[model samples]
Target: MQEGVIVKALSGFYYVEDGQTIRMCRARGVFKKKGIIPLVGDKVTYTPIGTREGVIEEILARRVELVRPPIANVDQVLLVFSVKEPELNLWLLDRILVHTERARLPGVILFTKSDLLENGDECQLWVSAYEKLGYPVLMVSSRTGEGIEDVRSLVNGKISVVAGQSGVGKSSLLNQLSPELRLKSAEVSHKHGRGRHTTRHVELLRLASRTYVADSPGFSQLEFGDMEPEELAACFREIFELGQQCLYRGCLHETEEGCAVRPAAQEGRMAPWRYQNYLEFLSELKDMKERRF
Candidate 1:
């Protein structure tokens, strides 16, 4: 059996690339009987049945799994945000970060449309804030090719997934990184300043010998109740560490007396927006628990 990675899955066929060539294969009955659906980015064992055809026999263990635009074994999630045209939304950015943390995948924040921003202070502030929390940040302008090389370096020899709100130039960024993509791009609504969906499905694009990028649909609305309230704090790396100092042993950090997180935010030690988003997530988790019980 030859080992290969699932680059794309459509209809009932999986396109597996084994370094040299890509084969169109179908999952074996064993996997189907076991209710195991192989996703793009999954490593599998398959036997070549024809020159460009094979049968996927076994799926290897996954390092990470994402629900929307389903993918697995992703090394990192590149969160793309635009400085202009569908302005950056801190709430959405935080939601993506929480999702990445929950999946134990590292995050790299990418800011697009830098050229459109006259000063770029707002975008720079966010980049600095996230960088303080140990996340890598890159500013790229697809139109000007600014910072494209840095973004490309991050994708080399790894499987990275790009996600962001519509109109943040996620597809445009992909096109810049790999000119071969030529993915569809949409303009932001002038009246609402929001982008229409351009990416319809999640497919892994092989950029180089070992670099793969999964372009996912732009999420206008994302839910974070998948994790419990107690577990939510862990999603924010810096806050999670500072929260331990709160007087209350099990403090949720919202309206709680002697909350270290609040003080940190007040002292400008932590990004206030990050704390606010955490509280919002905490409230949502509380409501979800109430409904569940």
Candidate 2:
């Protein structure tokens, strides 16, 4: 048996890369019987049956796992957001950031379509805000080929997953970095300003010698599954830290007396939009808890 990583899995066949070559393999019967299906990014042992073909013998442990794209052992998430066409969705971005934080993955925000940002101040403001939070933010335009080097440097030598809403130019950016991708790109609707979904499944692509990029379908609605109301605050690092300073021990940080989070937002110490999303997520958890009973 040879050790390799499952770079791609499609239609019940896994393409395991053993450094020298890729072997098309199927999971051993033991995996199905044990209910442990292999996923892309999983390190496994497989026995070669023929040229470019093998049988997966065992799946090794994973460092991280994501549900939406169903990838494992991801190093970081590249949160792509467009500055103009689809317009920025701060709420959705915050939600995704929180989810990445919960998964213990570092997130880098990529603002695409820099060429469309004629009013540079607006773009600067958005970049500054995220930068203040200590997150690495990049502004890139595939058409202009700006900031592609910086993005390439970040993704090089790591397995990074790119995610964002439809029309954010995730695939275009990928193509810009590695022209070999030749991935499909859709134009934004003049009426809705949203681009159509072009990527159908999640697959890992080798952009460079040691760099891997996972391209997945755009997300329209983001759901942070199974996070409790109390646990939700932890996902929002900024708010969670302020909540710790609240006078009340068990403060929900919403309309409560001596709520530190509210006061911080009112004082402009924290973004009000982020606080509002926290309440929305908390409300969803509360509703779920009530329904369970």
Candidate 3:
């Protein structure tokens, strides 16, 4: 048996790479009987059937699982956003951060198209805001090759998922990182102020011997799946740290008397935008919970 990782899934066939070469494989019948659907980034064991084919016999346990793009065992997420185009969507960025936190996966924030920003203050403001929340923020311009080395160093020897909304230069960044990929990218529509869907599937591309990165399709909407309204605060690193100082044991931090978070926001201790987005997410989750019951 050979141990390998599934790099791609297409037409019910899995492409498993075992360092030396990639082999086309099909999962055994036992997996279907057990209601298991193998996904890209899955560590698995398979038996070689012939020169180019194999049968996956066992699937290793996953460390992280994402339902939106259906990937497993992800080590980290690279959240990409453009500094100017379509404008920086802090709310959406926070929502994605919440998703990573719930999945217990670390995330890095990458601001693409930095070359387009006229002044340094624009990038500095965003960098300072998210870095305060304990996330590493990198300013990268695929056109200028700025911070590309930093990005390459971060994803080396790990399973990383690159995600962001349309028109954020996600595909352009990928192509810059790995020129051989030649991933199709589209121009942002000036009229709509958004990018068209260029990446249509989720597939893991081998970067180095042990480094792999999965390119996920760009999306605009994110739902707080299976997340409780009360648990929302814990997802925000800054809010979670400050909640300990609140007078109430279960403070929602929304107009609640003696709420440390609110005061911190008012005093500029925390970014007000992040605080407001937190409230919005909390309310949305509450409504989702009510609809479920």
Task: Judging by lDDT against the true structure, name the best candidate.
Answer: 3
- CA-lDDT, candidates in order: 0.87, 0.86, 0.89
Q: Write the per-residue lDDT of candidate 2 for residues 171-202, one digit (tens) a residue.
A: 89999999988999998887988878878777
- Stretches of candidate 1 off by over 4 Å are 218-220
Highest TM-score, which number?
Answer: 3
5-85: candidate 1 lDDT, tens digit per residue: 999999999999998899999999888888999999999999999789999989999887778668988899999898778
Name the better of 1 and 3 by TM-score: 3
Worst 10-residue lDDT window for candidate 2 reads 217-226
TM-score, cand. 2 vs. native: 0.94
After superposing candidate 3 on the true structure, give the runs of residues whose Cα lies further than 4 Å from its correct spot.
Answer: 218-220
Clashing residue pairs in candidate 2, if any? none
Per-residue accuracy of model 3 over 1-293 as CA lDDT, tens digit each: 99999999999999999997889999999899999999899999999988788999999998778887788888999999988787888888999999888888899999999888884445787799888778999999999999999999999899998888888998888888889889888889989888987777888888778888887873346777788888999999999999999989899999988899999998999998999999998899989999999
Residue 13 lDDT in candidate 2:
98
